[model samples]
Target: MSAPTEPSRTSDAPGRGPDPRAERSRAAALAAARDLLIEQGWSAVTHVAVAARSGVGRTTLYRHWPDASGLVRDVIAERISTAHTPPTGVLRDDLIRELDGLRRLLHDPVSDRGLRAVIERAGVDPVFARLKEALYREGSRVFRTVLDAAKARGELAADLDPDLAVDQLAGPLMYRRLLAGRAVTAEYVERVVDDFLAAHAPT
Candidate 1:
């Protein structure tokens, strides 16, 4: 193996940073890291390797990511945060749309595999775990916005806990993606939406 390369600060290319060049560099590094994770698994990713793969220098990779774990965490956050925002009139419709979006994300050949690896690593890595928590908090915030709209429209049970409902809505998808490694199809998304609606429809 080659000696670990020096650290350099590169612009984020994929909108991960503010500057255009930084954004571009950041995007390039993320894409390279994502590919490595999917192709070689998390264990195979390193700052030097990512730099080499991204056509960036080790210094640049290090400047952006303190370590391999940090790089992976940022990559996951960047990818998940940019997912499509779903909208539907009814609770069921909204949920189905959200779940379907998640399913499509999880089924993506490159991103899915890379995300799975990152999640697995997050289980044992404290820094990654914290990053994961922050990402989920942001995700929940997005979901809560929709739930609040549904509540205003009287589409959800008046007494239902929005947080719990969000959990219920996402729990199955997480289970399938993380543990079962099962396919998240349109049918599956619809089924989950229907089940939640039946159990929590406005009374």
Candidate 2:
């Protein structure tokens, strides 16, 4: 005899709240908010706009995110991990890999514009400024983790400050993007990685 067919899985299972449909709606709204922010800056992100772009009702977007800044904050927070890279054995290789990951993130048109928009808004909005500060900290986590691994592998001094090292590595990229208006290409990332490692490598 043939075996009985298994029950189909769905969002409507008993005792399961808000199911897959709700989750998909929420994700769609977030994606729409991100795209809007990238395409038109922070000013473009609103309840009505996100609702229209996401194909959900304004009430639903408003229910989950009361303010546009809250939605923007969530988007940026979720994207902080996009540039993360796992540790490699060699310190230089690890640093280069991390920088390369960053370069890819910056090269992504959506992320590039989204980041610039937030930075511009942060200059004038205190709420956005706070979120930006938190974002910077979150964005630095991967670098710190890589630094810790380098130290463990005897490639960096035990007393080398992880925060300072991360600043050294990321500062130039930000300067080029925000101040100098230079393209952060793979070559630029390699140079930044090399210069930082030359100065910080364990003696």
Against the true structure, what is each candidate's TM-score? 0.75, 0.76
lDDT tens digits by residue: candidate 1, 67-123? 787777665655665354656566667677766766777777655765566577678
User: Among these predicted structures, which one has the highest TM-score?
Assistant: 2
What digit string (tens of lDDT, one per residue) describes model 2 on residues 1-203? 11111111233468775566767877898899889878887778899899889997887677677677777766666665555656666777777787777677676666676678678888887767876676677677777887888888887877898888988888888778767877888788888888887787778
Which candidate number has the best lDDT? 2
Indicate the residue-level lDDT of 158 in model 1.
78
Candidate 1 whole-model C-alpha lDDT, 0 to 1: 0.71
| Native-structure RMSD, model 2 | 7.8
Candidate 1 ranges with C-alpha deviation above 4 Å:
1-28, 86-88, 123-126
Candidate 2 error regions (>4 Å) = 1-14, 120-134, 152-154, 157-159
RMSD of 1: 6.2
